[model samples]
Target: MKTLKSRPSAILFSCRARRGVLARGLNTTREIAMPEYLSPGVYVEEVDAGTQRIPGISTSIDRARWQSLVAEFKKTVVPQAPAWTDSNDTDPGVTLLELFAWLTENLLYRAHDIPERGRNAALRAATALSVLGHRCTTECATLTRAHFFAGQLLDAATLQAEQDYHREKLRRHNRMLHGFGIVSGLGVHVEATSDPGGGRVIVDPGYAIDRCGEEIAVCTGATLAFPSVGNEAFVSLRFWEHPCPPDSPSASGEPDVTRVEEACVIGFAQAVSPPALALARLIRADGGWRVDPAFVPPRAGAVMA
Candidate 1:
């Protein structure tokens, strides 16, 4: 009998000689069942290796997965196609990948909420997706409109008005329910002089919550003229939100004026005692500028909410 040894990594098999012929014969099989032997002396054998275990490919979809796929494409395909070097989100390939990711996420959400139904389900899904940083598509927008307004068709102006109304409502709720006052550092100090006209009251830099629940940041100290004698005046911090011209131009000489959201002013209400919203009160008698006995300067770093 001639003995043959297969490669070390392959399964070992032996064939014995009987009546001048090999007792066991080699048979052809599927490619995966056994590796083919092409060498002249190589022999094939059928071995029942049981069930083959094939590893599963990942089908998980997520933002990270999409990002990794983009990275892999950039690594493998960019070299072959030099013209497609741009890997930014603006790139068509990257944008398509993002859209795919969004669709996958949306489908996964629907699958997770398979039992959900009706317009409320659509609205909830749209709101949840929006919270997840997905922009509302036309269908989502329609669903949201139907849910909120009983399917009323809103024009641009009407939509803006509705938005403004809700915003003001929220603001009022915060201002009234939460209570507002000088949160810190709006101390009133009178620079007294023999002539009331020459005197001034300085308001230190401070932060406050106005009646509108809007935060007032006094970046720098402010000064207001002293009230005339025999008159009472109260200092109020007012907040206004409007667009103002930019203070300077950009280095590129382009116009950089943007609308400012918050504009605050230190104002005075004369002949009126300090109201609940007043930061300080000025009582001017025959004496130059008298601090009202009832007036207490807001303590530094004290919250008056």
Candidate 2:
């Protein structure tokens, strides 16, 4: 079974990347327990393409600026020491710490030519602002829209809907956008099997409803993983994507997947951070704020590469 800390489509990126890993000493881990502490709420898995057990994969994504933003935001917003004694330590979401962390990350200053990762981070952070019920201003919306592919994809009706949703987020989102100069009103939809009996229910990405009616993207995490015959597993993970269902609202009370419905909300919360910071940092204006020291990674669960 191949081991990868990356999401399903993760690690499995490139065969050549794996060809060199065997020489990188990871080849031996295949014989033992899995690797540890890569990202919070995230974990690497060992996969096999039949004869080959423990095969690792590496792949290329849209190369959005969000990647850089996450790296930078992680380096800055997250903490070295636990925010509070007895913090979950594993998931790290005690208090509004994540919220403050979000604010702190948005305060970071970058260069004029934002990297793709940075662009993604900026967009994600803006999205978070909205989730926190922060509104988006014209400037903030424009700044965020500059790099947000989803926003650009909107038609006049959709655009108007988005703007209306922004206003609905407590106050007008434009205020948060302009006042804080950051992205706001980010929302995520988690869709469990509308019908769980379909064998392995496919919680298709961005397939759920966003009741907020905002232009929130969907970022998924491992709800349930299926073990393979070769002792390997196929875990599902979702990346940030366009909001097609603007008027859709997530089902209330419980997610269709009983186990998933019972799963902690932290799991879903953890999925947003990386994608959020990535989008925020992507198109954030340069030389705007003071740069803080890098934040240490979270202790467990959500693992990064």
Give me the runs in candidate 1 sitting further than 4 Å from their true place.
Answer: 1-173, 193-196, 228-230, 246-258, 271-276, 296-305
Residue 220 local lDDT, model 2: 44
- Alpha carbon lDDT of residue 186, candidate 2? 23
Model 1: number of clashes? 0
Cα-based TM-score, every candidate: 0.37, 0.20
What lDDT does the true structure give each of the candidates?
Answer: 0.43, 0.26
Best by lDDT: 1
For residues 71-155, write the lDDT of model 1, one tens digit per residue.
4445455556867766486687888888997997698688863232332233233222222221111121211121255777876
Lowest lDDT 10-residue stretch of candidate 2: 18-27
Clashes of each: 0, 74
TM-score of 1: 0.37
